[model samples]
Target chain A: MSPLSRRAFAGAALASLLVACGGPGTTTGSSTSPPPSVSEASVPPPAKSVAALGRSVPVGLKIPAIGVDTSVMQLGLAADGTVEVPPIAAHDRAGWYRHSPTPGQTGPSVILGHVTVGSYGDGVFRHLGELNRGDKVVARLENGKSAVFAVTAVQTVAKADFPTDEVYGDVDRPELRLITCGGPRTGDGYQDNVIVFATLST
Target chain B: MRRTGLSAMALACAAVLAGAVPAFADGTASPTPVPSRSAEPTKAPSPATSAEPTRAPSDDQVSVRPSGAPNTGEVTPSSGSATGGLIGGGAAAAIALGGGVFLVRRRRANGV
Candidate 1:
């Protein structure tokens, strides 16, 4: 090809590279490697613990400043692995997955609760949406000790931006995440998922 | 026999070197850093940063009515459609007009 054509091609390729690298978290964000998993080979695994979201879960959740003291239940993915929440009254319980980590245990401990109950006064976790960075989420372990997590960051992700890797990524520090419905209401469903990312502070 | 044990240790070291460790007990963090071998370095979120309500989430809220949107003042955990459908004006107009004329006549004839 002529020098001009070659130069133009080079510029076009450079532009594409720049665009890919310019976005948020493009290289260092949610799209990175998945968090750790439980296997025979996990180097330096955290700890072995258990909670239940099926028929059992950890005790209630409380954040003093937020006035949120609700039960948490164990939650999990259905057959397809989409998030499965406990029934409405199941709030104030941590939805512990039989297969996932326990609160203050190894791996990601996922808990689901209702933001509100239909038209009622809202469920116990109703105020979960109000949690911000540095908020504390305390869960009483079956051992009588409380596992405390402080809110790290809060993001309102469109349902499509769930960031499965990020929300459930494995970190050395204990963490907490609060999920609820948000975004503009639509005929079919809510517009987005309000994902609150927190870390194990206490 | 010793060779087998040695090989197992080698693979474990490789997994660790490849940044194979995940960080949190929960599944919201990246792979665990293998001490000095971890490629990506990230600090555990500090415990004492006061709440910043106005600050944005990492990119990634509350009560709801079991509807398309969450109730106000509650957290919203939702996702967006990855691929958009045909939302062009033409499709919308056609959907409206095609059904519009048919339903209009029905309504008028049924008027009481």
Candidate 2:
């Protein structure tokens, strides 16, 4: 096979393996299972970065425009401690469960989703990258409550400016932040995270 | 607290990935780690939130449903466009298995 055909086949196969490897994240819910529960008692003490919130809380996620939906799973800090991806594909609607902060609580309920995939044009969060200020950001917790937050601000930060505090900072009110790799694609992935900061609208 | 969370996150990541490595004994795991950019840091922020809210417990029912749930229509592969549903790691790697789309990625950016 030509290099182009070979690469295409390889990429498809690898993605399939990842699906089988991760598959409906034990933490993130897929269409098949009931949403997982997020009990503070079950979750370990907060570590650092969103990764420490080891349990996945989302049952299933949806976006209006793109037909992206996949299982949600809990992702722990990686071997190197970086936050894990949504375990499976479905980039158009793929999102990360901000494992630490509880939904409808005093802190920010953060989620990182994909804006676009390397090849797929309709990544789960592609429109997430298009969200304007005042757009609605909603999250349903495993406990069965859906908290709605309004987009307050949107910015693109280089991977270096993760804004650890700002994104997952201590806040007295319930807040939400949506983050994804943004800006020019660096041959491999995005160079920065497109951050959409939202606060509970009610 | 933020610094601490990042570190904990890294450790948790290690645990998660290590758990997956053995699973890869079946060679089920994909080889795309190096291909994607890192998405998180290595530290923590502060006091954690318990699942049981210290706040009004009764008002928490709204947490169950996601703001949006995936509708099958949005991500399905159509008649003309063959590759639509693939999301992050797994999907990308799946494509690699067939030796398809990603070949273009390598060529699109010779420097990458």
In candidate 1, which residue ranges exceed 4 Å CA deviation?
A1-57, A90-94, B1-112
TM-score for chain B of each model, two decimals: 0.20, 0.24
**Model 1 lDDT tens row, A23-108:** 43232333232222111121232243234222123666777866876655544334322555656443334354333345665345
Q: Write the per-residue lDDT of candidate 1 for residues B6-79, one digit (tens) a residue.
A: 99999989988666445334344434445444332222111111222222122211110111222222322331
lDDT of 2 by residue, A39-144 (tens): 1111122222222122226655543333434434443343343554553354434444445354455566656555654435545566665665555555655866
**Candidate lDDT values, in order:** 0.48, 0.49
Q: What are the candidates' interface root-mean-square deviations?
A: 18.9, 16.9
* Residue B58 C-alpha lDDT in model 1: 29
Candidate 2 chain B has its poorest 10 consecutive residues by lDDT at B65-74
Worst 10-residue lDDT window, candidate 1 chain B: B59-68
Model 2: which docking level applies?
incorrect
Candidate 1's DockQ:
0.02
